[model samples]
Target chain A: MERKTLDLWVGLFVVAGLAAVLVLAMKVGNLSTFNMSESYELKADFGNIGGLKARAPVKSAGVVVGRVTNISFDNASYRARVTMVVDKRYQFPKDTFAKILTAGLLGEQYIGLDPGGDEVNLKSGDNIAKTEPAMVLESLISKFMFDKAADGDAKK
Target chain B: MLERAITGIRGTGHRVVNGVWRLGYASRFFLAVLLHSSMSFRRFHLTIKEIYFSGVLSLIIILVSGLFVGMVLGLQGYETLQKYGSESALGTLVALSLVRELGPVLAALLFASRAGSAITAEIGLMKATEQISAMEMMAVDPIARVVAPRFWAGVISMPLLAAMFSATGVFGGYLIGVVLIGVDEGQFWSQMQAAVDFRQDVMNGVIKSCVFGVAITAIALFEGYDAPPTAEGVSHATTRTVVTSALAVLALDFILTAFMFRGL
Candidate 1:
């Protein structure tokens, strides 16, 4: 091959390679979903977080507005302390309720935020007071069984 | 009988010693290539030519294989996920598998057979034909002039090829999942984007490819340089290049994956 032709082909190969990486990052990976805007942190305590992991989506009104950044255990409170980074564009009320919710029957878990009617908005570093723990299947099934046994006794 | 048993033990010891000696020599060669790499950088066109030979020429096979792999994943994933009525996650299955494991591993395997064997054969032939000795007789260092460019080129081309493989594979999955089978296109892309994290998954894959590149090229170069100067020896060196590179890539992949994706 001619020197010029070789150079052209090499240049094209490099270009294509770089373009592939760019596509992987922007389209296939989560690079495009990242919120580059200013964000603030909020903490919520739950009795059980279940499988809610860091980087899990934090959604309000079925739209993802933040991500779980930290999940830790609070020794004094005996609860799970979950920290989330929320976009500044969406502000929640002081009484917003945070709950652990699963997407599908067997899917990953995430945090769901339900806004409350309050005069003041929650600020950065504020703790959300109202929170719901993840629904544990074992406990739910046991409760159902207990209720069924109680109903049978009452009928007798 | 006792004399024969002693001979067998002697043979085994000789082979073991020879293998260890060769490993030490390969390590030395690796260091020499790194030291002599300045020439490859100073004359960038030399490295570019090698990239054209190794990277550009390997594009067709890499792309076609990626597509086929992705399509197969799409079909199989759909079949299994449909049982749970979660077929929308076909994209997640295909993208994660390709990006995390298959892309770098399969691409390196193919590269080892294609470009790596070719490099070993070429260098072995050069040594057999006295070309390396001729360069040395002319007071030119053969390692710098002949070996460094190809070494750097392999290192540079590897990650690019793997990325191309993964990107192509994802498209193939999309074609089968969304275009042919009529899955929701929005769900396909959104699910993939949500599941495949840029820093955790994509970057780690890139790191894996780069490591594979270094290992394959070093093995190829060392095999060629150490081969005996004969046609049979050169052919054996080429074969060894492919086999050793493949084993090295797999073993290194396990170690890297353990360190990278563990406890996550």
Candidate 2:
């Protein structure tokens, strides 16, 4: 009886530990978000993606509503095409603005969706027409330096 | 003076060779335990018993420490990230830190100190009492009946312990980030869910803890088995088990992290 009780407790402990791991994997790690949910895909084109990865978050009002499913280059258009999987529950208008945004100065880049006033709700296969490309910090810094040098030359 | 210098160099070389020989012997012992452990299922109950002692018993320390560490991370992360108005990333910072680094490394260190030392002491006591010799005389292989079960127990329990630690740590971070600090609860969990990857972060942490488990248990059992059959020897071996296991866990963590996060 005592051995059986000990075994029972051990079994309970193992089960609890396993449960915690499952929760961690599912909730914190987002392991089940991919195949476990009903989502629809939308595509957008950007001139520059910067450091946006395939799994980057797609957020609206700072809430993640989807993920970047794929990123590809369109040679003819000279643009980076991004495929996003938005949750079925989140319906956005056709004219919603999709902007590539960074969380902080040195943080990871993600897609921020700004909903626009449009009578037509975007369908799954529809493409977002307007997309703001990722802001390149290096190019901005270089531009500032060049502008300063130009000003110096003008003064001289 | 020239002759003395030559003797000193030879002495150092001899010490190096002796250390290598001892390491080889310990490795052989570990192999023997591993081989014997696979040869039978009769000792499964014994392995479970050891797990109860090593894994279940160690849960309190692991959980409490994980919570405290996570809370501290929440506080510090909030302070740092708030500077740039990214205090919302507190959840991300805490979860990533615990899952990627502190979760496995600290749990293993604590496990080494708590259960690993206990294992060494228990086995050492058995040796001191000549029970191992008695078992051998009775035609029972002590390696199979004794060390292998304990070894397997440690290995199996480690990843579970680490996962539990990380889970609780995440909770602790939640408490601080959302409850006390008034950060949006939805944002805290959502940010964590978005940032942390199951394969990259969680699984790698599990792998690290599993490797640490094997290393720690092996060191514990080896020290116990090789200790001089005396009280002082047992105590000394127990201390060595803690120190050696800690250093091994840290070194292994560094190497594994480098490989696991190489491209990123």
Candidate 3:
């Protein structure tokens, strides 16, 4: 092939490859779209996070409207403080409830937001007071076993 | 018996010394290639041609292998994940495996076996035929004129080939996961989107493929250039190029993965 034609093909190949990566990052990875729009931060405190990570999705009624931007432990309250960056387009009521939820029976954890019947809208820097911690299956199983043993002892 | 034992120890020591010497020589040659390759823009045509030979020609094998691997992953993942009642995560499993690990490593292995070996054979043949020497006689720098362009071409083409491989692999996974296995198509894709991250998974894979490119291409060129100028020497160098590049890619993959995915 002629040099110019060859160069054109190589350039085309590079562009195509980049496009593929872009698609993978956006469609499959859910990366580029998150940062494109304006977002506002809201903080929620949980007793336990249980694999809840930064960058985990924050969904409202099963639709992702934000991401967990930061996760830190509050020394005073002894709670897992999760800072979420919600897209400005999606507004929630001030009384919205945030709970940590797993994708599958034992999959990735995310924040599930349930909107409440409140006239006030949640603004940036608002603290979401009502938060449910992630359910630890191990702890639940242990608790169940302990309850069973205690019931047997009481019957005896 | 005593003399034989002494000779054996000496032989082993000599081999180790020779290996180190060869490593130093190859490093110097690679440095020269890198230096000359900065001027490669001036010889963009040669670089393009090399890329066509190395990257374009290798695409068929990469795509086919990627597709087959993805199909296998989908099949296996569906079977395993179904037992857990989480068959919907087939997309997440396949996409993550391909993008994070298989895409870069497998593409590089194929590239090494295909383009890397070809580069070695071609350059080794040039040396065997005294073509490089002739260029040297004409006051032309063979490393700059011949090796640098091919080196740059291989490096440039590697990451692109890997990305293409991963893309095709994802499609192949979709074919099996969504079409054949009766998986929810939306769940397959959406689950992957929710699971994968740009910096952690995708960018790390790209970084790995880029490093593999440099290492594989360097090994191929160094083997060819340093080969003894004979037909047998050329053949040996070609074989060594494949074997060495494969080992290098795997070892580098392990080290890179450990560092990149350290906290996770």
Candidate 4:
């Protein structure tokens, strides 16, 4: 009986440990999809994703108040469409410039908003009119390398 | 003495080139091994049973290790981040570090050192005792029946064990962060949530664990199958398996990390 009790306690401990981890995972992973005030959806057309992934932060003036939810591509326009949700309380003006930027030197990309001074406010589903696409660092490096090759050939 | 030193320099360069050539040869073998991989239903069933025994049963050690690991990582990470006045980044750091790299690597290393050597020794002993030969004589494909199942079990078990390690380590860190370090639970949790990405680093950790699993099992099995025919040979094989697998794990980590981050 004592051994059985010990076994049961260990089992419980394992379960408890897993539960704590789950809660922590959810909390830290930001698993809450929608909560705290209402949300408004906006879209951005990007040429590349950079390191931008789903749930990457959407920031206004460096303060993140939203996240990129879903990414879809338009074959017709050859543009990557990003769906973003911003906290309802913080209103987006008509001319707010949505630029997707990466954090730090090697951090994941986030959607940063440059709040505009337009008197008109975006409705619940209204799109942000101005947006910037993601920049490819690798492409830039390759371009530089090719430029250097061109210079070498010109000298030759 | 100066002539000897000059010769020594030349010899060192020769050794370095030979080492590189040897590595190229081994990689070809490793690639060959990566081929010819398949899992049947029967193989899967046996693999599951073996995994439950070898992997699931070893949860106690993983947990004991994870708890302490989480605490140590948390304490150290917190102190450094606090110095930068980005104390809140501790949650993000601890969570990302645990889920991304350290937790899985450390747990897998520990498991490899413990369970990996045991598996090698047991298999090596079987080979030496003619048990493997007997099974082959009885029409069992030793590679398929014994090796494949064991390999599959390691592949399946290591990820689950690694995840368990990550989870337990994070929880352990939380205990240090909140109870001991006095970060508010809400702040700690929210900061962690806002900062960590399940896609970026968690995927990396799990994927790395899977690779480590394959390496661990392959090296162990290789060492076992090639064990010299003596009792002392068995001991040497076991030691070699552990040491080689551990070093391979670290080396592969560097290579995989470089390749992984290269495109990024």
Best by DockQ: 1
TM-score of each: 0.93, 0.81, 0.89, 0.67
Can you write out model 4's per-residue Cα lDDT over B152-250, one digit (the tens) per residue? 778767777787888888888888988899877776776677766555556577788889998898888777876876798889989988898889888
Give a tens-digit lDDT track for model 2, residues A1-156: 377776886787789778877987898888876442688999999999999998788999987888887899999999999999899988999999999999878888999999999999999979999899999999999999999999999999
Interface RMSD of 1: 1.0
Highest lDDT: which candidate? 1
TM-score of chain B of 2: 0.96
User: For residues B166-206, what per-residue lDDT tens digits would candidate 2 score against the true structure?
Assistant: 88898888888889998888878877888898877888999
Evaluated against the true structure, the overall lDDT of model 1 is: 0.93
- Order by DockQ, highest first: 1, 3, 2, 4
lDDT of 2 at A124: 91
| Candidate 3 chain B weakest ten by summed lDDT | B37-46
Model 1: how far residue A106 lies from native, Å: 1.6
Worst 10 residues of 3 chain A by lDDT: A28-37
Task: Order the numbered candidates by lDDT, best leading.
Answer: 1, 3, 2, 4
Superposed Cα deviation of residue A131, candidate 2 (Å): 8.1
Residue B14 accuracy (lDDT) in model 2: 100
Q: What is the lDDT of residue A66 in candidate 3?
A: 90
The DockQ-based CAPRI class assigned to model 4 is incorrect
Native-referenced TM-scores of chain A, all candidate models: 0.90, 0.84, 0.85, 0.71
Clashing pairs in 3: none
**CA RMSD (A), model 2:** 4.9
Worst 10 residues of 2 chain B by lDDT: B38-47
Q: Pick by TM-score: which candidate is best?
A: 1
| lDDT measured at residue A119 in model 2 versus the true structure, 0 to 100 | 93
Which residue runs of candidate 1 sit more than 4 Å off their true CA positions?
Answer: A35-43, A69-78, A87-94, A117-128
